[model samples]
Target: MYSKNVPSGFPRGFLWGGATAANQVEGAWNIAGKGISTAEVVKRSTNRKDFTMNQITKQSLTAAINDSSTTTYPKRRGVDFYHHYKEDIKLFAEMGFKAYRLSIAWTRIFPNGDEAEPNEQGLLFYDHAFETCCKYGIEPVVTISHYEMPLGLTLKNNGWAARETINEYTKFTKVLFERYRGIVKYWLTFNEINAAVWGFNGTGALDDDLPNDQKMQLRYQALHHQFIASALAVLQCHKLDPEAKIGCMLARMQTYAKTPAPLDVRAAQLQDQLNLFFTDVQVRGEYPNYMNRYFYDNGIELKFAADDEEILAKGKVDYLSFSYYMSTVTADDNNITKATGNFALGEANPYLTSSEWGWQIDPVGLRIALNELWDRYQIPLFIVENGLGAVDELTPDRKIHDDYRIDYLRKHIIQMKEAIQDGVELIGYTTWGPIDLISASTSEMAKRYGFIYVDQDDEGRGSLTRIRKDSFYWFKKVIASNGREV
Candidate 1:
């Protein structure tokens, strides 16, 4: 898969890799001293068109927790990666991955999120996983807390809205830093940190029935606690391993104006600012000026400790990392047609195509996002997650000819190269899911995004076999030639 002609701007040693989350990929939700997580109780949405947060009231959560049916709760039986880590990492090594981005399930370590001592079994699990990656020369980029908060935290402290949750999370981070200091060098403080403000289901909030004002307040308060936790985690990571690189992860919903009208432009800018606010706090270590007005106008007051500002300043991240699967356009008018993708909604872009899931396919927007992030933070940016989620049919011979996924990835990689040429300091690119796992949004296996396919369905029935797709070989070549053989 090597090309004689290498890409011009792709510097040598550019980290090419894949990404997965514990809740989305790893099964064994109840094994190895792992506690139940908020992700486990999230029921699948029947209506795909309107992917709102599943109604997660206390009663529903309790029922789902006690429910013994893995078929109904598919996340409970992910891809069984917990038991198949060695086999999966071998495949990643076969693809010549420079880095593998995966999250450490918080519950795996803490079990209940406030434990006085870490679970040795959970620590040993990651210790062996990272050791295998190191054996294959694959760097592990670990997300400290990726959506899989222990359900106990939500029930006990109302998730991150309570001030005590911050201390608990800091304790979790301290354990991680002290334990995995040598094995994992790259760290992400939170996965999609802004989702709490956006009311995403995985932000550790289980009460979707609250009033709008109360909901907004809760979301922002949780966001504030997460911000403090992220900062403190960065500080803790540096204290443990000075060579470690910590970053803040954002959803990166790049928005464009529909027209040249000032209102339209302002709308797009405001939408972009709303998405960038999370990264702004982490990278700059201070809240952006515009957020004060936003808070006041919305009647949202954030509680902060006296030393929170100082802690944030001291704990600024070393890089900016984000997941960019699609972009959205915004118009000033209220009657504009809307498109949804990656948990964000916006006006549809008539100029661009869309994925089967209605995610706008704008390769150029990736270049725009990279340039914007680089210009804003003046720090290295990592493309932690980007991929197409589509249905795949296995032929009788057990093969998948997914040219659409190949095209999506090729176009994005080309745009990433263009961005690098345009002076964006990019650290690496890790496609969202290297192997097919349970979909985060709908909890369906059919919404596949991977070079490798796992034999599973939405109803939790399959032989649990792993097969390499055509794009798997294609990606191996791309990585081998350093993005030259697309």
Candidate 2:
């Protein structure tokens, strides 16, 4: 879309690729010694607007676990990436991907999360996957724990709400670091760790009827335990693989003021601060002063271990990675047109267009997010996830023409280039799941967000074939030109 007159700002070796979580892409959830994950039992909603909560309760989870078929549980039958890794990675190589951001299924490594010995078959699976990625010259960027946690952990102590899961998680990370020491250098401790604020963090919190104050208390407490665990994992990664880099991931929610009113501006500022509170803790090695007042006013009390502060201070993340898809504006008014997208609520931004799912499209918001984060942290940033989820169609000739997806990404990449010129040290951009995988929130194949289209229905019926959309070649060109062609 840009002419040669606009100089490209993307850095050399700027890891260009795609991202996918284990739970969202990898099927075979209960095979080869892989245990059930918290993400496994939750069912998808028929309504596009409704989403799946982290429903890891005792009764519902038990019933869902007993059923072996993946017909209703669409996530259990992903795009079948587990069986198609070699093919998928080969396709990525064809597109000249420099990196592939993916996650390890915790259940596959530690069947019950507290197991002493690791699962060899599960370990072997990833070994082959990583070796294949390396063979194709793709750097493997792995998230130690994505949205899925071993359901066994949740059943035992309600997942991260208790202190025990932290140790189990660290043990899992130690296994990964020792096994894939030289192969995987870029690591993320958690996927969207800040999602814990809403209790839909996928950390295995029991999702059921609960009082508002109690739920918030439990969510904050669970998030604290995760902070401790992440710090511990950071320390372990450094100790084991001295050359490795460990980071914290957040689902960034960029906010804007709906009007120039002073209260509205302040509301936007406070919301953005609260959204970035996770980065302040992980990147700055301590909680911000603002959250103290938040916790006090909300009647939320956090219990910390004796050595928690020391661990956090000693093991700060080397980088900060985040997923930025959409942004919303906020106002101080009690009632207005509410914005709903990517699990955030605010005033609808009339200045931006909306995606098919009503996510307000604000390419400039990405530039704003990058500048704000870089100015605050001053460390390298990685955009691990960004894409549009839409209903794709396959033509009679077996071709998918998705120009809308191309336009969405093209605008965002341009904004990223602008941010780089503005002095944001960007590590790379990995659009979420280059191949179409089941949606994590809604678990629908119809909500496709990929350059490669998978022939799978929301009901888990199709050839499971992978076809490249027009955007696939467009992205290939963008990568080849290092964002100059876009």
Candidate 1 residue pairs in backbone clash: none
User: Which window of ten consecutive residues has the lowest lDDT sum in model 1?
Assistant: 46-55
The segments of candidate 1 whose C-alpha lies over 4 angstroms from its true place after superposition are 1-7, 53-55, 200-202
For model 2, the stretches where C-alpha displacement exceeds 4 angstroms are: 1-8, 52-58, 207-209
For residues 1-486, could you state the per-residue lDDT of candidate 1 as single tens digits?
874544376888899999999988888988889998888887866755545546478788878978967777788888999989999999999999999999998899988988898899998889899999999999999998887788888888888878898898989988888888778889999998877875636457755678898889889988988889889998899889998999999999989998999999999989988898888899999999998988998889988899999988898999999999888888888888989888678888989998888989999999999999999999999999999998898999999999999999999999999998888889899998999998888777889999999998888888888999999999999999999889
TM-score of each: 0.97, 0.97
**Deviation in Å, model 1, residue 124 alpha carbon:** 1.3
User: In model 1, how many backbone clashes occur?
Assistant: 0
The TM-score, computed over Cα atoms with residue i paired to residue i, of candidate 1 is: 0.97
Could you tell me the C-alpha RMSD of candidate 2 in Å? 3.0
Error of 1 at 372 (Å): 0.6
Could you tell me the C-alpha RMSD of candidate 1 in Å? 3.4
lDDT of 2 by residue, 364-446 (tens): 99999999999999999999999999889899999999999999999999999999888889989999779999888777889
